[model samples]
Target: MIIGLHVQVTVNRPLGSTHPEHHTIQYPLNYGYVAGVIGGDGEPQDAYVLDVATPVRQQTGYVVAIIHRRDDNETKWVVAPKFRFVTEAEVRKATNFQEKYFQDDIWLL
Candidate 1:
């Protein structure tokens, strides 16, 4: 229920990096998860970090939107700085580097 609040995330996959296991997949942005907040995957909820242009180990930002996957059980949260409102189009473009394989919608808060 942190749909509109700022939360802490541990960046397991930083920007310009590849998945530890799926080496073919590359991360264009800071992709992480909220500790202790379990998702449908039975793990820490995964998130897509936005507005941050550089790689980081962790970050704190507002939960601006939820990327609900129609083809998968996983739902990713969209986090961005509180200073600006991120457009849905921007989210789609930023996450497309990886999310292109799945069907999703941006649920704005």
Candidate 2:
């Protein structure tokens, strides 16, 4: 029985190019997965598997949720579900080389 789930994600940022400075910014994001809603068995529901297109439609990246947090001087991994959204188009446009590079994390296809 699956009680919980964990997923890996990647983040990409835009950078200036040409005279300004031809450079690209990339970020590798990681976080624990938590169901947005509860399931019939009283467990958390898994996030519906979506391709890079999902983020493109929203024009946002997936937010990185730091499960570990500090509250009242007590630090522990919290279930805040905080995340950053990514664009599907940006991810889809990624090259196969990049995808294989970040295979452990989010895949670009």
Candidate 3:
């Protein structure tokens, strides 16, 4: 996904929420799926909402980057405020809770 594209996200996994299968892992940022969009995983396309101050159930933001996983087919979109920006290092830190298990790279718009 290109940056600056406004998109809505439904937060299936909010910040601090434990992973559905792996209870030991916690989501550091709002994590969810794009409505009505299917990804390589055969589910709704997943996205990570960043630059938000507090936890939320759902929101809309612009895409800043894509987290393409080498080990898995599913890729994740990084959403943030239009005026806000997230560095590559910050992106890694924010997603490392679960992403640590995958081989991935960040692609900015």
**lDDT value, residue 52 of candidate 3:** 78
Residue-level lDDT for 27 in candidate 3: 84
**TM-scores, all models, native as reference:** 0.91, 0.18, 0.91
Clashes of each: 0, 19, 0
For residue 104, model 1's alpha carbon misses the true position, in angstroms, by 1.3
Which pairs of residues collide in candidate 3?
Answer: none
Using TM-score, rank the candidates from best to worst. 3, 1, 2
lDDT sort, best first: 1, 3, 2
lDDT of 2 by residue, 6-107 (tens): 332221221111112323423122112233544333544222223333221112223222111122221111111233343444333332222332322232
Local distance difference test, each candidate: 0.88, 0.26, 0.86
Against the correct fold, how does model 1 do in TM-score? 0.91
Could you tell me the TM-score of candidate 2?
Answer: 0.18
Q: The CA-based lDDT of model 3 is what?
A: 0.86
Residue-level lDDT tens digits of model 1 in 19-74: 88889999989999999889988989999898889999999988988899999989
Candidate 1: clashing pairs of residues: none
Which digits, one per residue and each the tens of the lDDT, describe model 3 over residues 1-109?
2577788999988887898999999888899988888998999989998887678989898888889999999999999867366788988998888888999989875
**Backbone-clash count (model 3):** 0
